[model samples]
Target: MERCNHGTIMRVYRTRQLWGSGDDTFGRLFWSFGPSIHAFSRTVRPLILIDGTHLRGKYKGILLAATTLDGDGGLFPLAFAVVENENFDSWLWFILLLRQRVMPVDKNNNEFTISSDRMKGLLRAVAEALPGSYHSYYIRHLNANLLKTFKSQKLCKLFSRAAYALRESDHKEAMELIKAKNEKAEKWISEIPKENWANVHFKGARWNVLTTNAAECFNNVLKGARELPTAALVDHTRWKVQDFFHFRRKAEATWKTHLTHRAEKWLDRSCSFGSKFLPRTCSWNEYEVLSSTHTDSADLEKKTCTCGLFQTMGLPCGHAIAAMGLNKLDRYKYCQDWFLASTYRSTYEEVIHPTLDRTQWPEPSYDLLVLLPP
Candidate 1:
């Protein structure tokens, strides 16, 4: 069989053309990732980013992933599984895989930080099962929804105001301001789905809240491939993702110092941090998504800036927000060597790896394979 290259990908089989002999038929493949989770764990640690993108195979669903915090531009795809849409069971399965990959080596929950899209069922499942550090949803996802909900430039201003405003009273004032301007917008209180509204606090409200941008990014990564078939979909994706991380993983020292320096700064601020500011567990709260007035002075220090970039990443997140809540400076950031991109990726003690799975039944030594001359 003679074949020319199919651009970057080599042809598997060819009769007429390298890519295909005017054929759609391809090979069956199960999606696999480079470097098993543990091997890749050598690359980064503590926090993991997770999201489920839609699948285009016989089993239509989403592919959820656990990846490293991308601070050092190190966005490697760690572990992935085919999930049936973005639901509870799907997220539960993803979390279980995450636990298996991380738990044995890293005892304390400190090794895992999750930045994902806001899917209530998934969060609920995570809370019940893993009950560890999961990141608040990224703001990019929230922006799209807000843009759609509030079309006019004037209304969008309100969304921005509500989003960055920290004072409980200010949140109320912003909401009231919106209601006064656009009476119909008042429906936001009742219309915004509760699950969607998690962690978001309106004035005079309290609850754990965050936007899920990481999930959206993962979804966007898949969007380009959604229409692709199973094999092409997986292969093309692997190359792009692997290529990105390969470059990122190489500059280990740079990323490590960047994150380490930043993490330490906030850790310093977080000290004398009463448990009130840092609750060990999640306590649900309700705050309306920022539907606020746009302002020019939204710096990382205030944390109430229009851009929710820091809030989204969740790593000590935005410097501005950190400043606003002096007590909670440490609480917001994702603490992981990987996020820090530090020299030490993780602290998983070097010990015999244990197989907690019942499936690993013992095998007799005599059962070992032997070769004989015939």
Candidate 2:
């Protein structure tokens, strides 16, 4: 695989047998494509969404995936592994490999925010493997659990509102509504750490992503491939990823703006809304944006706004846009580089070379060991 797809990282673990012609058996496997890893390191957001889906091949196991969102809000897969089961050890092994081979902490001490379901094993794995990183729970999963316990749609909706709320006050108001409706439900939500599910409390930027939907979307695309043999599964993923890169590369070439289509649309909406607000200059970089409803403080120097959307979404909020317009500053300059078209181009710049036929492969110098499925 490495020879075919240069720079690919693949590892296989074997378990020793206690009896009978003692031969090692397949224990686990992990792989990350060269292009995918390079793309993520160069351009994608630091947030990773992880999830596991059961495989239905002859040797039944679980397929674990680590995915991220690209600059254009598209799903970009980083790494994948197949394990016998979803346990603490298995999850820990995968995460460790992910850190070492895919997203190692550099001299700058870059950290990532990992989002997944509240599985006991995965939670423990992330804590042990990435102590410095922020971990978040999927709000959809949390809401589902809340619904299962309370059997109330209204409570679930309120819980979602609290999780999605951008400001502390808004989040507090949503919680109070929940408390007024059902004290037990409010208590149940309070038990889980706010940083794990609430947007206002999370220490890291989530890019407004609240769920493992990106990973799920990749899994759905691999639905049929999940039934293939181990080798075939890996090959299928490679081809699919290659196609994704090619398609996106062509699509990006047609873009005329400095930002992605999604980013441009978001900025346009904010700009239109901001036009209705009046900006009162407090300083060269600070301004008070006033509207009929409320007043918001926007600091162009800090790239922040009192509305909370600026820092949270990594994009200019309506208030910030209004402030930028007042100073005649380029609104695109205030946007994060992750949304830049240049970054998107760099992500898909590398070509994913196709693998040669197996029959033409060279023999290994070392003796081949007979292996059995776990």
Candidate 3:
């Protein structure tokens, strides 16, 4: 890492704990990001996905990741760390560095949302480090944990409904159903706060993501690099992320719609679904969208639907779509700026310039000892 850092302004920050009575270290952490990642951070969604994977090399360790979501609902790499383990201190260090170097926001203000699989120490670190942020757990992870104790598929399905239910009433219905079958299941989930896993109480746009799969996706991308030496591993990740940015930027240039491809597809699907229900207007903006089983309130002026998908996803729901059609309103106007192709392109516009050859590197101001596995 020292050799690579000499040639470029790209930053690589690390910390190590020294051992007593010997020239040895116990644990170390390596964190780095390229110019493109820093630039990309400005354009991607405010939601961050955090997770860790085990390294498969001679020196086993945890690969901590912090990733963002693109406008098209794709994984946007922000930063990474090779940490000794996924302990509370390690997570706190990584998150603090992320807030300081990458985000640079007030610790007491809610400007970002974090999604995770509810790792043991992560909850505590996030609360201490990012007091103002919203931390949502992956619902699938919670269900899997419950499955270990209660193996009933019925309980799992009810639990999923409770988590995925957009409306508060609907979520309550699912929870009640779970209580009827197994009071233990209900008690287990009751321990976790509603805002952390249930969509009905989520503070911000989750974009239909129920898991920390985006972070996992990036881990898979760096699977082979996990075995490389420290210096080589960093360079490998840099190149891989560079290629990703370049490819995504160029590929999206031909997109014609104002919204991203995924957003457009979602809108189109909603429009098709809307065609099935004829909305009855109660006022200029308010309408009652009726289905066979239930009716939803659609308020075009508020950009909301009682079904909750509209506000949750920042895209029109079927009820909202039906209401808009009844009012002869343009569907495209309802789309949020976050899902625009322009936003997607802006995220990858910056380039991650390659590192200079080793011979052209400058001398380090201070000597850095090479860290060996403990």
- Alpha-carbon shift of residue 180 in model 1 (angstroms): 3.3
Best by lDDT: 2
Q: List where candidate 2 sits over 4 angstroms from the true fold.
A: 17-23, 107-110
Q: What residue runs in model 1 are displaced by over 4 Å at the alpha carbon? A: 1-47, 57-59, 102-113, 118-123, 132-135, 138-153, 165-173, 183-241, 249-374
Cα lDDT tens digits for candidate 1, 167-240: 45566677788789887776764465422333344221111223444445556766777766544565565655
Q: What's the lDDT for residue 239 in model 2?
A: 92
The lDDT ranking, best first, is 2, 3, 1
Please report, in order, the local distance difference test score of every candidate based on alpha carbons. 0.46, 0.89, 0.78
Maximum-TM-score candidate: 2
lDDT, residue 218, candidate 1: 59
Backbone clashes, each candidate: 36, 0, 0
Better of 2 and 3 by TM-score: 2
User: Which candidate, 1 or 2, has the higher TM-score?
Assistant: 2
lDDT string, candidate 3, 163-258, tens digits: 899888889999999999999889998999898889988886676678767888898899888888766877888788778878888889889998
- Prediction 2 TM-score vs. true: 0.96
Please give, for residues 1-374, the per-residue lDDT of candidate 2 as tens digits.
Answer: 78877779999877653223445888788999998888777788888899999999899999999999988899999999999899998999999998898984461223688889977599999999888888989988998899999999999999999998988889999999999999999999999999888999988877779977898999999999989989899999999999999999999999999899999999999999999999999999899999898789988889888888999888999999988886688999899888999999999998888888878889999998766878
